[model samples]
Target: GESVGLHLPTLSVQEGDNSIINCAYSNSASDYFIWYKQESGKGPQFIIDIRSNMDKRQGQRVTVLLNKTVKHLSLQIAATQPGDSAVYFCAENMRGAGSYQLTFGKGTKLSVIP
Candidate 1:
């Protein structure tokens, strides 16, 4: 799905440098989360995921950290490359309320400066 916004906050990182993207969520009942990378004209692709029982999880060059107390989520990219340039979004799985619901945060566009 597309990151819904006309103007999104952007984070620019130098090539080969590490990048950190942050997100804040309101629902405390959320249990699962996933980070997706979306390139222009394409749908978002899964990068990594973390569960509420876990504080952090790693996959390939990406790491996802969750702080339930602060209801904050972060995605860390190691050794950023040109291919990593894209809009990143965090999705939360909201359990209960009769059925499962997934909420998406405003995306951050990461630009790798070569």
Candidate 2:
């Protein structure tokens, strides 16, 4: 398990193939998790999300898995597309004192080759 706050900054996948992106979080107290995709010069867009209580969650063509044991998180794309090329980020929603804040990882750039 690794963090967007750590590890390599890029990942490359072939178009039409499945892609698996990984993220490692630092806060064990984090209860909520989200995946964001950011294209060049654009804001990060929500891709998917999972709660600490859930081990897995699925979306249209994406899936998110959480391993609380090792504090690891991953995103699985069913069909990697050129449009999917972007910087992927993992963020955590931490709560304390009756309030919550967001913490984001570095980001992994996904390059889709046709």
Maximum-TM-score candidate: 1
Model 2's TM-score against the true structure: 0.90
List model 1 lDDT by residue over 1-114, tens digit each. Answer: 454456899999999999999999878989899999999878889998899999999989989999999999999999999999999999999887689877899899999999
- Structure candidate 1, residue pairs in collision: none
In order, the Cα lDDT scores of the candidates are 0.92, 0.89
- Model 1 residue 108 CA deviation (Å) reads 0.2
- Per-residue lDDT of 77 in model 2: 92
Residue lDDT tens for model 2, 3-103: 33335477888899999999999989999999999877678899999999999999999999999999999999988989998889899988878887889
In terms of lDDT, the best-performing candidate is 1
Tell me, what's the RMSD of every candidate? Answer: 2.2, 4.5
What does the lDDT read for residue 48 in candidate 2?
93
- Alpha carbon lDDT of residue 89, candidate 1? 91
lDDT of 1 at 8: 91
**lDDT score, residue 16, model 2?**
91
